[model samples]
Target: MEARTKNVLEPLAFLFQLITGILLFVFVIYHLYVTHLAEHDALSYEKVVERLANPSFKVAYFVFLAVVSFHAFNGLRAIILDTDFGARNKRAVDVLCFALFVIATAYGSLLLISF
Candidate 1:
């Protein structure tokens, strides 16, 4: 039963990783262009605040943060699963990865909200 469940979830997890990877690529390129290639004045403190004041921008930025955090930790989980380390303690690996993901995403959210 456990093996059957693992088989079912493995494909879903792979698909999730693929989708998140694509999203991260798009989000990162957009972020880089906005933060780095845009006019210097575009990133002024006031401008940043004004941008975040828009609800759409705020929601999109939060999604970006969540996607990036999930992708990073999911990748870490995949790497761990590929090694002997995870074979002995798969549940621990999953718990650690999830905890880190939550912590990272929460921290980023706080920063965005408080800014």
Candidate 2:
């Protein structure tokens, strides 16, 4: 008996999706707590400016953004892979998902920076 896969990267991709999903969950919890559950006015303009002014905050924001974008598209890719169309067009699915991830991450980063 032998294990078979359409692509060698399938296992790696699954691992990535799993890890990113966990990270996204943690990040979303933090975001929600800060924005909605925190005692202070976390959503106030001044507070937002202060937080964004910190270099570490910016890096954390970028990581959160990237993780979120990757998780979204990777999960989408997984769903697509489950379908006949994606299974038959693995390369096409990969390219499309990667392109979408890059575009979304770049746009989100730009918006964060400009904020």
Candidate 3:
């Protein structure tokens, strides 16, 4: 018996979902610890500004922003795709979802970097 290959788009979307999920998980943990459980003094507004001022921190924040939005929108798309309504409109759905991701990344990066 021969194995079947998936439609290229489905596999790509699945891969993106998996990768972003893992990224979101790791970033979320780090963010929670930093925001909620780290040193008390670091919780100050000025300290937060100082942290965000770091280039590494800015990069991490942008990554977190992009991954979170993608993860959320893609996961939602996956859920909806299981329904009859979604099945009939895959192309439109994919395009809309991609647009959403782009828009989110643009807005989120602005907010993340302008710190």
Cα lDDT, all candidates: 0.88, 0.87, 0.85
For each candidate, give its TM-score against the true structure. 0.89, 0.86, 0.85
**Model 2 error, position 81 (Å):** 1.5
Per-residue lDDT of model 3, residues 12-95, tens digit only: 879998999899889989988998788777788998999999999999888888898898888888888898988888767778
What are the per-residue Cα lDDT tens digits for candidate 2 across 13-106?
8889899989988999988887788857888989888888878878888999999889889989999989999878877999999999999999
Residue-pair clashes, model 1: 0
Ranking by lDDT: 1, 2, 3
Model with the higher TM-score, candidate 1 or 3: 1
For candidate 1, give the lDDT of residue 28: 88
Off by over 4 Å in 3: 1-6
Candidate 2 segments exceeding 4 Å error: 1-7
For model 2, what is the error of residue 42's alpha carbon versus the real structure, in angstroms, after optimal superposition? Answer: 1.0
- Measured with C-alpha atoms, the lDDT of residue 53 in candidate 1 is 85
Worst 10-residue lDDT window, candidate 1: 34-43
lDDT, model 3, position 72: 85
Query: What are the candidates' C-alpha RMSDs?
Result: 1.5, 2.8, 3.5
